[model samples]
Target: MKYLRKLVIGATCLVSMAASAQWQWTDKDGRKVYSDRAPPSDILDKNILKRPAGRVNPLVTNEASLNAASPVAAASSPHGSASAPKLSGVDKELAEKKKKAEEAEVAKRKAEEERVAKSKIENCARAKQAKTNFDSGIRIARTNEKGEREIMDDATRSAEAKRIQFIIDSDCK
Candidate 1:
């Protein structure tokens, strides 16, 4: 029972440590930001009030500790650059997910643009064909709201030609 309790407690501690926020900083808009990832490079060191456990901030150098620990040793430490946050595996995963989301957004935008372009091209082609038919002196007929087919008069044909020309002007270019 004692051994199980100790194991459970240890596991909980490890989980909590992994979940705890490692970065805290005031953003440009003055909001305090708490994140498990490093603050953006634009954030000044003074704005970063907290960092993951043992990163040595160059801006707030501890003179005594710096003297005791050789510069070579600090640079060679497993934690990475003393002045910068060590990127954890979680940060890498998050970065990869963000990049994929951005790519997906770009692809979605490209697809929408292509669809709009295709629609415009189809509209332009149909309008040009209708304009050609109108110019060829063919009498066109349209159904009225009363469900009766009506032969177009000269005024109606000219008006229709104007509308088709407007569509061609807007979509062909």
Candidate 2:
């Protein structure tokens, strides 16, 4: 009796769901038609619309079958045995060799970077020495020469004028 009642209720739900399914079609000479079933062959390529039959509600389906037979869990869980998936011997050896090669390459890169950094420091020191020598020449002509070298007043004045002119020409041009 209970099984019969359940069957009747299930049939009623399916009928109601199917009733909501809709489709539309247009004929060749501009006529419109609608039906739940697929369109006839003549207007198959014309303006045809099909609303798919409803599916069982996902929440209801999942709740009803949460613990039911699941092939996914069975296949993944070791075929009812405790043995684990094992890599082949060749694959294991290849993985170890690849790891060692990667480590060696990393070490080589680190050594190259250290060499470049040391070379840059030496080059910067050389550049600083050249700049210091050039600056000393300019200082001697502008300030140090005037302070230390004894000369006639006219000659000293002319030398200072020449230094000022040289600075202006070099800086402003």
Identify the leading candidate in terms of lDDT.
1
- Model 2: residues with Cα > 4 Å off, grouped in runs: 1-90, 138-173
Residue range with the least summed lDDT across 10 consecutive positions in model 2:
55-64
**CA error at residue 165 for candidate 1, angstroms:** 0.5
TM-score of each candidate structure, all chains considered together: 0.51, 0.30
Look at candidate 1 and give me any clashing residue pairs.
none
What is candidate 1's lDDT per residue for 9-34, written digit by digit as tens? 99999877765547777899999897
Q: Alpha carbon lDDT of residue 113, candidate 2?
A: 90
Tell me the whole-model lDDT of each prediction, alpha carbons only. 0.83, 0.58
Model 2 TM = 0.30
Query: Per-residue lDDT tens digits of candidate 2, residues 1-173?
Result: 99999999999988877766755557677777767877777765435643446422233233325334464443444333245575455787788999999999999999999997777666556555544545454433333554765433546555655665554444333
Residue 25, candidate 1: C-alpha displacement in angstroms: 19
